[model samples]
Target: MELHILIKGERDISGQIYTQIYEAIESGRLVQDQQIPPSRLLAKQLGVARKSVADAYNRLTYDKKIVGYVGRGTFVSGAAAAPTLPHIEAGKAVMGSLKKWGEHADMTPLETAYRCAVDFAGGEPSAHHFYQDEWRSCVLHGLRQCTAKRGKYGETAGVKQLREALIRHAAFSRGVIATPEQMVITNGAQQALDLIGRIVIEPGTCVAMEEPGYPGARLLFTSLGARVVGVRVDSEGIDVDAIPEQAKLIYVTPAHQFPLGMPMSEARRQALLEKANRIGAIIIEDDYDSEFRYSGQVTNSLQSMDKFGVVVFVGTMSKVMFPEMRIGYLIAPPAIAKAAVMVKRLTDWHSNTMVQYALAKFIADGNLLRHVRRVQTIYAQRREKIQAVFGTALAQWFELLPTNAGFHMVALAKRDINIGELIARARADNIGLYSLRDFYYEAAPPAGLFLGYGSVDANAIEPALIEVRNILRAMLWQQKT
Candidate 1:
């Protein structure tokens, strides 16, 4: 039973789980009448979420290759024959390529907020958004619909209602106006990035990204073999003047630059759009955390300002809603949407339509909007609490950057402290502080650590910073010795 499941360079859990099971059956490794491992056991073996394994099993059952009876275990169907195998040595030859990816497996480190040690980290939203009654109710409603359409391949363009609701929501919230037909639902913003890269990026194409930008975006573009060019960002967000006119695409977090916490000013936004028009470059506007703005009205998204249809606006529910939701959308220009949809159709088909339908009902009913407002009020208070902590002891050691928006805050470490040593010591204190170098390419590593404030409770701020300050003190002592 020489069975190996391979998902090459993809972070998708759903496919990995399903593919492993499929490969085992197809390669005569999992014979007909063989009892498949229970979902929990397989999930543990693969180091994946249990929900994913169960979903894969359910998919297999729908295909009639596996079946189950009440009070009995699941088994491969008798009608299904074990697939014939190639010569043993021929199979062994491909093993190296399969094992090569094991080193790059994306097992994200445990974020430190669970320990209540770190005060500033990236990607933390206030806990008010978590376990909210409305969100749970929405999930329940979503579940009810899933049971109705349990075994169906979802619509390739996503559920129509969800697409329509997204159009209304975007116009009202982000100022992007588009027909429902012009948007494509995705598993998340990450998938949207991947799909866009697949459609546009060929080997060696130059893609411009903001320096000190979202690490995920940079990683995605680079993974596609695009030579990533970093454009400098400033108080007004990505510097349009700094971007080379010849680049094929530019990725920017204009609403609130990741980690930098700066909004692209009107002039700069216009300038970038104008430049994009002149150079025929595509602008990827990531409005990931804009829904949680602490003060003032949420600015119009770049998609809304695009007269030339050059902006590809990306949004996600991971930050504003929940990470597990895995729902995001790309608001593309009509032409790009047509191209992206063709690519998406040949790929995963579409994101879970049941979930999309439920989200549609959630948005159309005004529950999502109401929930966003409620969470915004609570995060506003938490933001103030975090700011107060930074003003005291931490301020003496690091300079706090201007933060007009987003969940994370940036701190410029004083030169006297060794940033890397401070990070290692801080982690030992159970504090999770990330450095800017983690987000940069090897040729150029940016300085500083990203501190996510959203995940930290308001009450825990002082204690977390105390641990961080003590760690810095210890690092200073080590340097003196």
Candidate 2:
């Protein structure tokens, strides 16, 4: 190892070397068990006599700071305690320039506790039912294949086999038709949104989305300096006529709108496509958590109905499998898809190749479908339990939103109630509840609770809701008095 010891002026050579080495050890620059350069070589490099280097080594060994072996030369015995440096506060000017949208952004989603006896955290899936053995087999196959191949950076668009598998899966399941070339694999739906934002949004670009939409998408657009317009959403999903005429991009969670849990109506979907075509705006369809629909007629995706090539459909495996898998894809028109590929290359090159390969095999081997079917049954039972409880016990205080798809449902407060206080009280009782206020960007969001059935098991749902009903009744009575 090369030691950066500076011996300047007419100081005692031996003492200077000793002090420098000691300081290096004390500062943790010289770690324990690290071999030092030979005394002869160090002396030659430092332009000092062998005696000076020898004296320094002798002192360090005597003090037990280092150990010299017969043939092993010298090695640091142990690391010294690191010295504390003077703290330097960031200057106001520097701090001011670093202020971004995230600095003042709503942090409710991140701050909310996830673990509880009854968790209603939206977008979370039950990992307890995952097919561990099947997934392990697929992963081992991918690993073996990857080990045999040349280790280099894969394509930015992602593994070709996975794209092909997604094409088949999307076509068979969501009615979205796209070739492998039109898709770009991302880390997750969030990364897909970020890539789209990077390619489409410039400073002051007009972007329109649902009023109470996904916070992740809203925060992404805001951080990019886009002029975001919040379009009002009804029971039929985002109101098409409310969107600005000059919007370059319109983000929508059409399969099941975030927080509110309503699918976009057929009439609204057609009108939205017409409006986007007339205005030359691109639409981002985030089809998150549409795989497990419990009731009502299943609706085709906006991308499947799109004739003008204005829709970019984004989907994720996080809801179907798990969030930590971090795999999602976007299907776009050739022009936008090509640009998205380039943007993805610039962002992080590509996602995990092994996972992608494993997922491709998983999908091809029918394990993915089987897993979704298994979990769908579990989630449907929980959803039913939630609906039954709400109908019987809590119907007076909360109005359940009409929802057929997705793992979560929203219930609006029937009477005036402090949502913030309710959530705090619920937390105190070991019940995790999430509010809808953070989903709204520019509109007065309704007072509601997003009840998710993904994390909480079927057996626990009724008990949790029973307790929630008692609490709600008490709060309502207190408010009246």
Candidate 3:
């Protein structure tokens, strides 16, 4: 067998040979029990003295990095392995030429705290409410169907049945009119955003988003070398005039603006569409959590209002169903949809066929609609309970934002207080809270907490708020003293 050991000009020849061989073993280039070249052959190849090769082999043997049998040649040992160290060096010098946006991209999955009695972390759905038995039956049926068509790849756009189901569901519920061919199924809304960014954003391209917007979309665009512009959002929703004219893409949570839950007014939505048309920009409408409106009239999606094909509608089942299901769809124009399908094929060759088939059945059999209707009632009660408690007890510290939709709401701090300190203190009291600062990309966000009712039990909310109120009172007292 050929070995890749190098022998230097005489001085430290044995040491050099030993170092190279040891490195090769550690890096897995030389695997366990793989025989090394005979010392005589290695010496002849390197034009070095046989004794020097023998010496290097002896040193490696002493370190247990290699082993030899009486009849057989030397082999790499199981003990020879790479050192377990921090993946990235913690210094600026090592991160040369790393893009600024890449530095800000946090790919870590959101973790749920096991120790907290009440968790207000946003974007999580109630696991207890999921119809496990029905869902399992659907999964089994999907598995059987998938097994029947073994060895064949499903469509990149999605399973035909699922797309048709989504089209019907979207049209009936959200007023979004799109055929199955215009939709592309993705892993989640994140991947949909990534695909849009891939096709649209070039280096130095302008991407406009709300100031306190979805950090995931911002990070995705920024990482793709787009100059992300933060637009101010008011109670009416994203200010249409505030968006940069040069922006190629605009990301908006129009149905329910994230953190601050306010659906875009119809007039504002029309103005946004006009602005996008005039500027030739693509609007990504992330209509998340529009299913659970406790009160007020439902507004048609911006996609339904589009006449010029500028709005690309993106929706997710994660918030309505469960996060782990990882199902989302994008409705775009035929041209963009074709390109996106090609990109989707390149990305992962389509999302999980089995899960897609299961979700299709779940929606078609009206289980999804039934689930949403049931959960909406429960979430409505929880929302009222939170508002009642806050209006009476916790209103002194927090000014609750006006919202009629979505599972979460923001409580802006009434006084000058450190939200981080408050979060830390609340955790000690077994309450989980998140800071609004986490969502902001440019502007200095107001101090606040995102109180989500999706994951917390309806019974535990009032007591949790009481604990939160106590913490805020004590903190305010400390600040005054």
Candidate 4:
């Protein structure tokens, strides 16, 4: 490799070399033990005198930026390292949308499950349930395939194989039908929502989301400048009538609602679809974590039921696989997909292609189905344990919301207790508990706790709940006095 040094306007050539080398070392571009050109060779290369180069080298050595061996060339000193960058505060001219996002954001504690002994925070999967060997094999396959296509840019729509694989998986698993052209793979369901938002949302655009719905989704739309209104959710999913007529976008978690696990009834699904068709609005169906159902009829995806091209079906491997996997797909209507594809291209020009191929192979080889079936039984056992305990001992303080699908179940508090205090106390006891309050926007959501059985072992469920029962008892005793 040639190292070119410019000698401009007969200025100090040696000084220029010294400054460039020092800056490179300080910026981490040059690392320790890296060799520099011979003094004579460098001087000849720059058309400068050997004495000038030697003088610069001597100065650098005294400063400990470079060290020279007797026989070998000069190398960057071990002491030479990049300095830490200082944090800069945002300027006054920063975007107003960024300020709004900060005001509305809570930084939802998503991966807190692994940090505590007993965790009830939802939307995580068990490490023990992940098919490591199978996934590793698929990753190897993806790497081999990726090596052959190194210099090329891929389609923003995504790798063709992965799109086809997602289409097949969605058809059988969720009863949703789509072609390769209709689907666009994303970094996660979160990004899919963002792309869809980019396509439709404008300043003051009306967006309807389920109250106490996914907080992450709420923040995304809010940052996109949507006037998000919270629609009431009941025993039957999101209330169709409560949705404002002006709302151009509707987001729902129908197959096991987030934080509150309740599959939308068939009648309610029809009503929602009819309402969306009537209002000329687009619906985003985030069918996350509903694949691990224990009992009841497997609900068809809203996209499957849509006679009108309104529903944009979104699904993620994060909940089914580990949270770090970060692969999701969205099946949208033709016009929306065309717009979403263009938006996705402008945003990032496509997601990571290698991981997409790995997931595609995972789904194609039947590993994904096997993995889900394998974990479904384990989750069902944990769910049953929570169900049995909530009936026998937990009935005094909370009412278990009837749910048969997903890794989490919500329990509405029977009476008002200091939830903030309860959470802090639980954390002190080495248990991770989360409240549903953060999910609500306009009004205070009903007091409840989302009991996720994903990370907690089945055997530990009762013991943890027993400890919670004791804490509640102590709290009630104090409140009465």
- What does candidate 2 score on TM? 0.85
Best by TM-score: 4
- Name the regions of candidate 3 deviating beyond 4 angstroms: 1-102, 106-115
Q: Summarize candidate 1's per-residue lDDT along 1-481 as a digit string, tens digits.
A: 2224454554767777676677677776778887777777777766667888788888888877688877778898733364676765537878875554343244223344355344466675555554466556776887887888888877777788888988888788778888888889998999889888888798888899988776677767877778889888888878888888778889999888876787888889999999999998998998898877766556768888889988998888888777778999998888888888888888888887667877887787788888788777776776776577668767778877776676777777655667887777776766767786665542375456677777777677777777777777776777789
For model 4, how does the per-residue alpha-carbon lDDT over 169-264 read when each residue is reduced to its tens digit?
889888987899999989899999999999889999999999878888888898888999998898899999999999999999999887678889
Q: By summed lDDT, which 10 consecutive residues of candidate 3 come out lowest?
A: 101-110
Query: Model 3: number of clashes?
Result: 0
Q: By the lDDT metric, which is better: model 1 or model 4?
A: 4
Clashes of each: 10, 0, 0, 0
Residue-level lDDT of model 2, residues 1-481, one tens digit each, is: 5689999976799899988888788778888888888889999999989889999999988888889899878999866766445699778877864666347454425755347777788888998999999899999988976886657888899899999999999998899989999999999999999889998899999999898888788878888889899999988889898899889999998888887888899999999999999999999999999999888888989999999999999999999999999999999999999999998898899999899999999999999899989999998899889889889898888888888888999888888878888888887888888887878878888898878889897888888888888788788789779
- The runs of at least 3 residues in candidate 1 whose Cα sits more than 4 Å from the true structure, single-residue gaps closed, are 1-120, 126-128, 131-133, 143-151, 296-298, 442-446
- Over 4 Å off, model 4: 1-89, 95-98, 106-114
Per-model CA lDDT versus the true structure: 0.76, 0.88, 0.88, 0.86
Candidate 3 structure quality by residue, lDDT tens digits, 100-198? 535664532246537478888788888898889999999998998899888999999999999999999889889998999999999988889999999
Model 4 pairs in collision:
none
Question: Candidate 4: deviation at residue 375, Å?
Answer: 0.9
- Evaluate residue 480 in candidate 1 and report its C-alpha lDDT on the 0 to 100 scale: 84
Model 2 steric clash pairs: none
